[model samples]
Target: MTLLKTPLLDTIREPADVRRLPQEKLAQLAAELRAETIDAVSVTGGHLGAGLGVVELTVALHHVFNTPHDRLIWDVGHQCYPHKILTGRRERIRTLRTGGGLSGFTNRAESEYDPFGAGHSSTSISAGLGMAVARDLGGGERNVVAVIGDGAMSAGMAYEAMNNAGAMDSRLIVILNDNDMSIAPPTGAMSAYLARLISGQTYRSLREIGKQIAGHLPKFVERGAQRAEEFARGFWTGGTLFEELGFYYVGPIDGHNLDHLLPVLKNVRDAKTGPILVHVVTQKGKGYGPAEQSADKYHGVVKFDVVTGAQVKAKSNAPSYTRVFAESLISEARRDPKIVAITAAMPSGTGIDLFGQAYPDRTFDVGIAEQHAVTFAGGLAAEGFKPFCALYSTFLQRAYDQVIHDVALQGLPVRFIVDRAGLVGADGATHAGAYDLAYLGCLPGMVLMSPADEAELMHMIATAVAYDDGPSAVRFPRGEGVGVERPDRAEALPIGKGRMVRGTGEGDVAILSLGTRLAAALEAAERLEAAGFAVTVADARFAKPIDRDLALKLASGHSALVTVEEGSIGGFGSQVLQFLTDEGVLDRGTVKVRSMVLPDIYIDHDTQARQIAEAGLDANAIVAKVEGLLGKAKAGRELSRAG
Candidate 1:
């Protein structure tokens, strides 16, 4: 209950309360809201910079429009923390991103104010257009506003939605929250004044007349008129790009100013003709001193000191998996000049930033556009260069088509380094890398490997670089390594082969682990041995192109074989099952097989250990499955004796 003195914000329970106040008080409300947001996130440790950027914009939207009725769709939802506070969740603002607390992103079920849940980027325009279309079909006359970021705008989906919305002539409001990816300072008072001037009644009337004239005129005449309009808008407001896309482009206004936001938003809300884009320029970290000074550092923060605005960094004993990947890539690049790295707007997250330092020319940050990054890497691979397309497993879903058609189908030698390949805490299901195993494993000519540890990851990276036959991928989970000493030089491993961690024992139980779950598998083996049954543990290095020889051997040596992976169903386990069936191993009748994968349900934000335990892939769960199999064998022996 760390309460801040938010006198203006304390009076508000919902956005309706915000509207009830006079226009003069709205500015004060915005200031108070910003302070309250800072205080709340200082306690909760969620997204701060984005919410701070949109303080006045949030205030203006709620003030000008009748929300809930006027569907305000927030794309990507990271900026919705302030929106949540204004829309009746202020009391729970401090509980953000915690277990059983308010989500980091918006959820429809969480509140009516949140019209649509957002996690994946560049979806707001499409969803807002849909809402507008739905409204046209007897829903209501309410306005639909979609607030999207500059980083999100880099995604092609946003352009697609705008193109469609323009053609459909849907009455939708798209607010391009131009934080500029924290690259430069936001728009100043001149831009704000220009926005206000264009949103006036005279400009609206003239624009309507010009549109009518262009519609009736000949093709040549219409082209001339359209060019004139584009030139006029572009020269005045710098919006030729949006004008061509069919949206009535309106601003590059300062988003932090309530005066600029209120007038333009009110005008757009009142005047309805076609799709409108309000290009509001906002700083990522607008008000707070620490945030404004270092937007990226404060963009996503840990719990920190409020007065000094210093963040708490917990010291770790081991290096993060990201650093290991970066260092390994650098080592590989030093020897091979043909190797290159690509990231989709997550240089730091993918460890490509570190790679960029050593080999700046070889590193390409494609900027928030995953689909382009994949195909771009595919193009690079086609030219006989080793192109590593490093993306988070969840984000890679955006570029699945490119992986299949452009890379795999074409038999290009693209290397995919799928990072954060397991349930991630705090960010929850939205960013979890749970399904890459199933998705990428099924593709033809795709070589899929999962590293058992950091050292294994280095080895896998080398393997991917060495393999020039077709596309190769290595999925590794989030967080630090298991304290394994990394090799100075990584050697390539044989494709489709697995190594035995524990030698085969006399007992009828075996555990085969995939990815980083090898440690758990070994622990389970130890527990089984302690329980009077000898057990063996093996690491299946590759999910696709599985080690058929090793698999068959494991199956033959044991009466029961259990496969474990930190992935959803129909992945490594399914592949193993299919292979065993094809080989007639299941028909032997003496052996039983069980697969332990993540549950069918989407596990939410929790510690990785807890998530593994809940999915029944932990050491205890493995031991239980083994004991059950052993008991079944004992029962069968008694039945055979009776016979």
Candidate 2:
């Protein structure tokens, strides 16, 4: 337990406790909260930099606002650790991101303090706007505040909410917590803040008077005045961009200083405004030395040394899939001049940063905007550039409309390199890439492939690069490869083809494994062989296109056909089932067919092995399914004999 006994932190259990404390004591509370956040994250290994950055802001917001009644939404929820500790979750703070414990991100189900759930970026404004709208309808005076990050502002959704809120004239409070970076360094004007503009009372009064003057002026005069204000603001706060979007822009204030945060928050709470945007600039890792120095690396950490600030990572024998993708993409980019890489804020996570190192001009990081990233890649693809749109499986869901309308329907030859395509350990259901296969595979003319390991992923990368007919995708799971030997040069694997890994000329039972589940399929086949059942294993490289010849042969030859995939119900298993049905494979009735896919319900955070087993796609689960099916067949034969 990372529990600390600070005079200030110890007294607080809720927002009411925060309110009860004297305003002078808020600074001490923030310091204690920061220490507690670092200590707790050191043991549990969560989002340390973000929560550390917002320590003062969190205290101020909770203290000033009547929370649970008033809504406080933390965008992306990476900074909610301190918020959670102060809001009745301090005892379970260390249990964050573990199985049956508190979620790393803010979950509404977990606590009333969490008015809206957040995991993906840029959704807080939209959710908070809805809450504010609901409050208006319900005739409630409860405050609705959405604390967003500069990173989240990159997404159009945040702006859309702002636009709507501005037009509707909703009393919404938006705290733009600019840590000066998202995953990588901040891009665009989102990180720009006013230089000492909101530090003094004179400027605040002038800005308020200026807003009143601008509103009363004629349309033409207002435009002229707005331009002049923009020029003045460029020097003062650089918040004209937010102002143009219909938000009352305030600050470029020091987020670390409680003296600054407390009064601004109090003013915002008291002011009758339509969607106010308070620009608070804070360091990502404020108090902690190591985190402050190397913010990105410390953003998400494993259990680490609190004293030295060294992360305690387990030794791995294999290079991670992320690194392998980066290396392979870099190699591909060297040979092809047209090849371009794009990621939605996740430069290092997708390993696109390594590709950027090789070809800086060729790599584009769109920042928290998956929608723009997808369409931007589509535009490049339209221009005959080989744009590899790399995104994590879960994050890509945010841009699925672009994936369908812009890329797939238009038939742009965009290469989608879907990372974290299976159960991502620790990140849990919100971050799982379980639905990519189902969603992407269903698209017409979309070619979907899942690599069994790192070596195969290299080949898939090459395949995606060469394919120009339509949208093509390659999905690979999170973490390291299965220690396969790396090839000096990559070759494109044949489209719509599957390869047999085991069995002789024939076998009674056929196992068609997809994605990273091949290793477990082989393990299950070994178990089946020992039990006197001849088993064959085949790796279905392409989820789309189906590998008809191979699937038909397996079905016609084997007594039993089983499909295994690390995806949801509508993905690889569904594809196999639909294809077999269309081909009349099941009409024969002799082959007992089974499709193993992740269930319809969302599974919580657990070890990858445990998650797969729970999904019944693991080796032991597969073996059990096979034995049960065989046992049923034997009983049927015995009943026939008796009859």
Candidate 3:
């Protein structure tokens, strides 16, 4: 007779259910939990590998600790999917990361269980510390646990929090999930040190025996046993990184084995002393074969075939803009020895992987520290090196103060290769690079340029590197170029210059395009041309310096001017409008000026083309607006002709 399948997980609507389960059945419950996590992520399509890796840890945490009351803060919270599933979000898991769906990261707005919201890395420990301190001041007896990965631990903020927590001696738990990687392979001295610390055989042996002894020790003997335990901890834990920082260090334990994890977690839960750190060793893609082997690929994936683990790749006829930037940087670096590359934990994403492979000595992966990366580049530039600080437009926000104080203040020539400058599809608003233009434009002594296509981007990169006076930025979009043929040799374009893409007669409408949005403007102009309206297109390569000559010429020549950019309203268009007003060009005539840009609201993830259309920055939208403006122009002319 077949035994009935256990309904253990289905009944686990709350932590009470988990707490009720016998210690012997936790392993089976963990199995069911893993299956549920996999199945949930398979449908929802978000942060699969991280959530899968933490299934058992999540189960053990909720089972052992009282959550919502006992705070569990997840750093860089993309790994909190399983936590969300366990905390009454199982049914709504299908909506993850969608416009109205559950958030990809832990959101305090989403649940009481999520004590703090996190998207970027290295914040959990700090947040957890705040909760712990608050709980103490209020005289609440609740545990505070922060689960951070080894990748996130490389970030300086993690250590900053650790340093602060060590001094406070507050009762807290810091779980370091060491799987030997972040988004890419982990970098820096901290990762290397942690790796060596965890791998020591003597430390492991001493840790196991200490935990066994600590579990049996009476409360009265605990204080007296501490002195003896210190010697045992030093023997087992080696350097005592956390201990020195004022934490009771535990583990480097097998995170997968329930038998091993449960006992350690239970012991740590009972400990009422200072901050404790449990170093858990778990594989990223624990059970899934393909994900287990290549964790990064599965880290954040699109919809994929479950059986083969194959993603249906988008058919792009042209190479991605990132590929172009990588190729262009490599070509430039080959010619100039002074040219160095820097990325803040994004070697592959920013296309610096190629440069790192070619010139490993010159390339630097600063590790999830954008602030450090920018300042480091500034330091390099002060030493007469042309440092290209390649970073995503969104991530660059974190280093604004550094960019201004460190680079722009000194007028250092730090070449910022700003990738994903527009609406990045699927990653949504949090990852969108829309605000860089506005922020970068406002900085004093900063020069900003955006390319219309890959070939222009290559020239812009050369221009940024060659310039020696102040910080220069070259912003480009997320996807492939418009299939334009790239030039073989790299050449520097003149700084603070704009180029005309299409010429037109007097009284014609002038379209000033910035960045990759030039393609859409060109298409709009073509449609306007067909309707017997003269249309001129100008690529405003420079945004900050404001190509005065081009703006003056276009204002004098055209009856109507429209500025188009794949950025916020206060970006290229605002600069152009300010120029027109300052030059007394707007006063000369009734020059009907219009600005086309991304809307003021946060746009959701979809195809780039769809996002453009939704924001009314698409080809058809531009054409319609221009045509309407021309109709008014013709009507005014008719009144003049009739008079």
Candidate 4:
């Protein structure tokens, strides 16, 4: 592949170099930066469309603001690829999202330029506000700027921050990157003129003078005067919402135009306003032909051909866990008219898009607001609807309070279809769904099921649909299922029941597995059997309402019992251990018990296989764990014989 010419981008090592360049040359620099961002993402396969959209904005921000000291915060950080390239990281840009390389999102540890690390959306304004307040308390003169996407504005947190920032006197600047859809038409010379005039020092001084004049008037008159001023400005600019929230609003400016972005950013940067919001509009995939044509495909991509824009996707023999869940749910919804699906701005990611295609009225995309999605489903469940709230396990953490207060406490039959339940590759620790089992298992009257395969996933979906007594969740991992023929008709399993997958006879050692780690346990059992030790393998099925009878049977029947799960420490293994202790199974000292779970440390971005191996949840790790346990058991036996 021929490298795109980035002549101007090659000369720049940092934002300081960007500042040194003349304004006329800055446009050329932005073009080079755009080309470089596309080329790098095409090679590395990270977030492309967002970064592409922000190329000029990034150049303008770096050029206008004294970054590193100024504290420029990118809201979601997927769009920070352009920012990353300009912030002395261009040399290593190709290593993005790879193991032991640059992160796909902004990471504070990776660079001082990244004041706050972000993988999730709708956090920049809050973080930037905190920084602004701190800077004021410290008597620092450094500016604080937050650039947030329009989609991120859907979350309540963004508005909460704005409300607080609006009420305060702390100097902060917020740039609303409205790329997906337009709030207003930002065109012609007149719009640019209005943006410049509104943000200009002269306009700000006159506005402050008017506020002073209003303060002297009667309360009613002051209120009327404020309304009139806001009405006049908002009539032209559509900033009344922001003005009411206590921010000096500007723009609906062209984000792609460096000429437009630079002057406005510089105005806000120097303005004495308490909090200012500049609305800048741009296209998601602005430059590259394929990306510009179909922004969604390039939003997140695999390593793609720079010329042809074709992504390199691996061939899969079986359907993905996400696809299987969607298909099963669609099948179930066909039979059940009350069934509904909800997703928090992740229709495609959670396979809710397919469900929507089948039943559009039954599907809801809540738009980057996980908390709202949870409660919305609760309301649906209250109205006799079987609402399946499909969310990534990691994203569900944002709505824990609603999960407890709204759903679980009220005994709402909200079926949580948790996708991405284990170590997610490329996205790293921020996106890892390692804590769902731990968080949800402790909730009373909650039914939690982890499927061992795609077929089991189908059964679990049916189980969740039938479980109308309380809140229930099914968590599956982020990749292709192990090839297993799915059942023709989905059958709901008995609640809290487990099935022994192998070794019917009472073996010397038993491996109790949960979630998708059953395949590893089975493989480990084979290795143990070949080594002249009998091994039994069973799938716990449910993390909560854990298979109590199976737990006792395994504890008493085996000399050594090793519990394995693809979750953190306080999950399935912990549940079993608690049950055994409570039941006097551990008091007898007849069997040695061990638990295998994900490691305490956060694993970096890598292949899912590599990450699971590192977490010691793989077949080899399970075999090693069993071998170690049996060694201790044999030693105890020998000591008893001598005694």
Task: Please report the candidate that would top lDDT against the real structure.
Answer: 4
lDDT per residue (tens digit) for residues 1-643 in model 2: 4446787788787889999999889888889999999998888898999889999899989888998888899998989999999999999988888878889999878999998888898999899899889988988888999999988888899989888988887789999888874222322243322323342355668867987888898988978987786787655566677777888777777777776677677777876667888888789899999999999998999999999999999899999999999999889888999999999899999999999989999999988889899999999999999999999999999999999999999999999989999898778888999999999999999999998988999999999999999999999999999999989999998889999999962677899999889999999998778766778899999999889888888888888888999988899878888988987888979688899888888888777877777788889888888877776344455568899
TM-score order, best first, reads 4, 1, 2, 3
Selected candidate, larger TM-score, 2 vs 4: 4
lDDT for each residue of candidate 3 in 1-643, tens digit (9 for 90 to 100): 0122436777777776888989887878777777776666666577888888887888889988998789999988778887887798877877777656788888888899898888788889999899889988999899999999988988888989989998986888888887764222333334334434443445546656766787688966765676676765566544266777877676666667666666667676776667878877778878888789898888987767677888756788788888888888888888899999999988988999988999999999989899999999999999999999999999999899999999999999999999999898656777789999899998888899998888898898888878899999999888888888889876898878899889753557999888888888898887777666778899999998989998888888887898998898788889889888988888877678899889999887666777888889999888877877777345556568889
Off by over 4 Å in 3: 1-8, 14-16, 40-44, 181-231, 530-532, 624-643
Q: Return the clash pairs for model 3, or none.
A: none
For model 4, the stretches where C-alpha displacement exceeds 4 angstroms are 217-221, 632-643
Total backbone clashes of model 1? Answer: 0
Model 1 TM-score (2 dp): 0.95
TM-score of each prediction: 0.95, 0.93, 0.86, 0.97
Question: What is residue 359's positional error in candidate 2, in angstroms?
Answer: 1.3
Error of 1 at 241 (Å): 0.5
Q: Write the per-residue lDDT of candidate 4 for residues 1-643, one digit (tens) a residue.
A: 2177878888888999999999999989988888888888888898999999999999999999998999999998889998988998888899998888899989999999999999999999999999999999999999999999999999999999999999999999999999986887696578888898899999989988999999999999999998898899999989899988999899889988887778888888888769999999999988999999998888999999888999999899999999999999999999999999999999999999999999999999989999999999999999999999999999999999999999999999999999999899999999999999999999999999999999999999999999999999999999999999988988999999999999973878999999899999989888778777778899999998999999898889999999988888899899999989999889999999999988998888888998999999899998888878776344456568899
* Model 2 clashing residue pairs (backbone): 194-237
lDDT, each prediction: 0.88, 0.86, 0.82, 0.92
lDDT of 1 by residue, 1-643 (tens): 4466778888899999999999999988888889888898988797899999999999999999898889999999989988999999988888888877888999987999999988899999999999999999975799999999999999999999999998986799999998865422336777777787777777889877888978998999998987876787688677788878988888888787887788888888887688989988888888888999998788889899889998887788778888888899899999999999999988988999999999999999988899999999999998889999999999999999989999999999999999999888788889999999999999989999999888999999999989999999999989988898888889999999999989653357778899889988888877666655667888999998999988888898888899999998989999999999998999978689999988899877666777778888888898888878776344456668899
Clashes of 2: 1
Q: 570 in model 1: Cα distance from truth in Å?
A: 0.8
